[model samples]
Target: MTTPRYKRILLKLSGEALMGDQGFGISPSMIKYVAREIRSITDIGCEVAVVVGGGNIFRGIAASSYNMDRASADHMGMLATVINSLALQDALEHSGVQTRVQTAISMHEVAEPYILRRAVRHLEKGRVVIFAAGTGNPYFTTDTAAVLRAQEIHAEMLMKATKVDGLYDSDPAINENAAFIKHISYMSVLERQLKVMDMTAISLAMDNDLPLVVFNLSDEGSMLRVVCGESVGSRIDNVTDGKNRVDRTAAVSESYH
Candidate 1:
């Protein structure tokens, strides 16, 4: 048995992750696999909340290149997030994991509206809350929404699931020799211009003294390892205006296999 580092955590999954190896659209197999991984965490008694992105279907900022209205495009992207949320909800329930989808915009027909206090109660009862629709506002990315929800829920940490295993000084796939950061300081990440999250999201996390851990969700058990007191990838914490900061390398172990 192992003690957990964070009792409750907000896991942010990009819509692209749901796409998996299919290259486009939701990959049924991949969603189930990911849901199983999430189930493993809940089985261990850690409350988990997920904030999903809509980039897989559409991206508001990307459409700005064309004649699309920025606000309208962003709203469309938000709707895309709801689609992903329902997909995840179905997959998770099929895996026998209790799940809930809450949107920033009130769409009671599809899912519950985002109510911070209510979401916290859901967690207390061991339900996984999926926050979709990206803050129900334009110009705010899902990354920022994750930060906001993590704060409102008083989450112990934020787990950002990315294509890469952790944060790197440069692009990992393009740069084979790029160094992977097992841990980094929040201020340093901002000062040195590391691409973890957007400035707004980073600022919120910094102000709240919330540690954000980056890891590869493609790998099995990575999320579990982080919550159960295992350092998987780069942990960004400690800011000049916030709490103390430190960095260290984490060896691969059961912290998550």
Candidate 2:
């Protein structure tokens, strides 16, 4: 049996990751795949919490670019996140994983309001808690919401699930010679503006001393390997600020293969 490095973690999943090749709304197969991966870790006695984004359904910042009121756009984005959260909860339950959906904004009909004690209690009872609605406010990204919830729940670390394998010096999609980074420091991430996560999210994680792992979600068993402390992706921590960062050799690969 493989022991996990962190007993409890907050897994951040982007809504876009749920879209599959359709490039639009939710893909049932993709969501089920994600649910099964999450269950793999939970079955091994790991406490998991999730914070899902709303980009696939709606993007507040993108709407604001078209002169829409920022607040209204953001609110709509929050509702979109709720839709994804419910879908995720259903998938996890079907996979035999006990799950709960809690929203920052009160949506009593579907999910319980986000309460710190109740959320923690759910994790203690081996139930995965899905946090939706993004802080119950506008103009904040789900990335920030994930950090906040992780801190509130005292999660050991935050796992960011992306299509890419790990952080890179450049956008791997455009640059063929982009370098993959194996390890980085929080301060370095902010100073270099690596964009693995939003600045607000990075700063919060830095201040809280919470380590973050970024890895490819589409790859089979990647999440389980990460939880088990395998070197499957980039790890960002408080190591020496900027003196020692591991840079993988430049390689060419499709963004999602």
The TM-scores, one per candidate, come to: 0.91, 0.96
Report lDDT per candidate: 0.85, 0.92
- Pairs in steric clash, model 2: none
TM-score of 2: 0.96
Overall local distance difference test of candidate 2: 0.92
Tell me how candidate 1 scores on lDDT: 0.85
RMSD of each: 4.3, 1.7
lDDT digits (tens) for residues 130-208 of candidate 2: 9999999997899999999999999998999988888987777788878888888988889888878889999999999
Error in Å for residue 94 of model 1: 1.0
Candidate 1 lDDT over 1-257, as tens digits, reads 55667899999988888887776779999889888989888888899999989888999999977989999999999999999999999988998888999999999999999888899999999999999999999999999999999999999999999877788766655555566676677777787777778888988898889999999887788888888877687788883455433333332321111
Window of ten residues with lowest summed lDDT in model 1: 248-257
**Largest TM-score belongs to which candidate?**
2
Q: What clash count does candidate 2 reach?
A: 0
